[model samples]
Target: MDAKQTNGGRRHFLKTGAAAGLALKVGVTAAEPRASTPALPMPEYEKLDALALASAIREGRLTALEALEAAIARAEARSQINAVALRHFDLARENAQRLSRMGRAERAAWAQTAPLAGVPFALKDLGVAMKGTVTTQGCAFFKDAVADHDSTLVQRYRAAGLNIFAKTTTPEFGQTATTESRLFGLTRNPWNLAYSAGGSSGGAAAAVAAGIVPAAHASDGGGSIRIPSSHCGLFGLKPSRGLVPMGPKMLEGWLGLSAQNVISRSVRDSALLLQLTQGPEAGSRTGPQPGALIDAITRPPRRLRIALMEQNPFGAPVHPECLDAVRAAARLCESLGHVVEMAAPKLAIGEMFGSMGIATAAGMLASVRMREKETGRTAREDEFEPLNWRSLQLARGYSAEQAFTARTVFDQAARTVDLFLGEYDLILSPVTAAPAPLLGAMSLDQPYESFVKVAMTASPFTAIFNMTGHPAMSVPLHWNGAGMPIGAQFAAPFGAEATLLALAAQLEQAAPWKDRRPVL
Candidate 1:
């Protein structure tokens, strides 16, 4: 490559690019155009998940090293878009050693030969899962903070024999919407590095979107999982409040709105992983739900009822393309023999956003307090992103008298879904008000409260399910002009994962994301 006409061109960035080896695909060929800019080894890994990689390993088409090499290389090229906070290549290689020792049949049988068995995977560093790994929480506040134990989801992934490849980034205390944090800078979207991947699971979504890993663990409270998932074009779900357990930390998250799940390329993968990990971990909210979330996916959903609204009910305009996509899905449902009608129960976007703000801000303050208490440290208001600190401040503004009213609003909204759900199998809506935003689009410079407002445009519909404690899944049903993914959310009633999974699986079979990938 010739020297750039300008000193600050991509060429200059390449010299100081400073990509970590373990972050992206490793074996990128030099022939590629982006190769001059330190591209990841292979672009293909951007599209393939652990399950597919496992298949290649079994088929003798690709070795784990080949896969890992490719992933690390991609991280080098794409890390700027979605910063990968931690690398465990040594541990991952150790896990691969065990996988290499196992007979294919043994590994496959144990995986139930499940799709992801023996595949490489990653975890969001936010939750507790020491793995002797860094849990930066996107903060300078806890730069040295390391978890002492694995979160339940980590244990489940290990048991399933998924190689723990890397740790993705997140916002501090996951307080804000975009993925940027002081600890690791920012995680940009693959489609446009200038745009955000969406947060606090933004790093997780970015990694998956950039092809660093096929799928990664993420948690959603006020759209942490789904928002990034939507932005990154991966399938993301916030399992019903209790379907996936959150224990050893708190029995319920965000007053039971948050839950652990993943952003994946396929619905069955989400269902499959949830089946593997979800259940009543001791101290989980409510007892185990039913037979199994995985088995639940195989059965055909009964001829269902569906409510479809192509417009953002909150008065925000759904990008015309997104509106068309939702309408198309409704038409598809109609073709498949389900009842599809335009019915949107009255919902106030402002009230819902306000309640979500309190929940998010309160959670941030709790994390800050916990950090300070445990480490003998205190955070000045300036240490945090203003939006996050202000969220806490706003949360403090409410009185006990207001709490009841907020609860009433949350419960009433959620219950409306319950009642509406009784008449419909699932409610289909745009996952975000629009497509992924440019980086700094949701920047902290805006009034703290305004962040929530801007966030509502794409994320408004998601929090409703969290409020009601119903299971919600985001499916990658549409792609924009840029080939970036846009997801449509399907929400089911409380304890209705069985219902949702069954429906999701059918959709997966009908339209798969298995072969779709970006040019990493």
Candidate 2:
């Protein structure tokens, strides 16, 4: 687990509970390949990108049941990764039949509507809800919090005609970066079974990377989305604070510290999902930008100056290899015809993210307390990692004056990054300080400082955007020679999802990763 291992050897260091899950004795059964991927498809599911699945359905190349069957088979074959949280063969089959009953015009409308229709989408354990299924946020208190109504995101997905085939796992309260929870144990990386998938959206990254669904829903308050996406070699975006709505229940997530988005294998898929799920809910305060997402994907980004970041104020070391990855990405952008230059802005990392973390952890603690009151049970001290307790304490310390000062500081930071973006179309940086880590590399069971250092080191690149409310994305641009994937982040001005998306589309076209996969 040495960070200085130059040869890309074993680098395990996952959050608490993950190190133990890597060798759970759950052997993965390899499914027959789809005639392309280097990794054999697991028995339960064979993933198809959102766009590809729609095309296949439209062309009659495969029925929804056929696709679901392949996916199920692939899931079974790759059981070691432990991606699927709930089996929905019966439900998926039923929905596919219902789709078959649609009239031609209805079917056509469905096809052209949301970018992910007719595709199998896995819902991450948090935020989104599916009726009759448990929506535990990795807590034993509400272990039976079966969802009675669909979350806004889930409703929108259904409206777009996506089949809700399964649910993925998450760490309790999603406080920890690793995805291990007592309920589902641990979710391992698809590339190397001995490593972590990453969290709080770790399960989605693991499932998507394993070709479980091509992509799954992900969220980030403090690098939850980007860290896992970077670790698993997928596309991850944390949108402008208000771009997507969280309504009928919440106006802002983690006091505006988090946003929900998808982590996928393609830029187009992320683009389309952003289009569908972006914008405010009915009772939302603000609406999405006045433009179409499909149109954004087609718009070519103008070549422009770029600001590259490569330093941390927290005394955390950015591994030499990770720095190399960022430099390589800078050169790639130059090769692709953009003026790239190094520029790390002076930022207050620990103070800002610490505040944000407190707010987020407080949200979970509030939930825990509520459950304690309602269910006559509480989370024992031993049940949560030390950082979880610290987050609760930090959030409790938020006085009225402190809250006001925090908001003012965030607004100021937003302006700073906005001014920074005015000169450059994109900001290039490493998504994490290191590459993919081995299981238990990070620990929910460790001391608060130990877990914080590990989690922050791997995810120093993403939270700055949450405070600023900018649109940012993680593109899977690098693969360590030994087969682990690494991601580099690119961010744009506030409300500039279009620019970020178009730039990502250009990269996708130039270096397609559709058929590239792991050998199970």
All candidates: CA RMSD (Å): 8.6, 10.5
Each candidate: what lDDT?
0.70, 0.72
The reply for model 2, stretches above 4 Å from the true place, is 1-47, 103-106, 112-115, 287-290, 373-379, 382-386
Query: Judged by TM-score, which candidate is best?
Result: 2
Q: What TM-score should be assigned to candidate 2?
A: 0.87
What digit string (tens of lDDT, one per residue) describes model 2 on residues 3-77?
245112211211121222222121233332444433432222233467667655554444565566556666777
The lDDT leader among the candidates is 2
| lDDT tens digits, residue span 1-520, model 1 | 1223422332332233221222223133222123233345544444455655666555434445556767677666565675588888788887676666665566556655345555777788776565577777666676777777777767777877677778888877776668877667778887677788888798888887666777788988877888887777777888877777676676676666678888876665677777778778876547447447777776778888888866675766778767755666676667667787777666766787677666666666677778899799787776777766666677767676666666677778877777777777788887778777776667664685666567667567777787777788777666777767777787877777787778766666666554455555
Q: Give the range where candidate 2 is weakest over 10 consecutive residues by summed lDDT.
A: 6-15
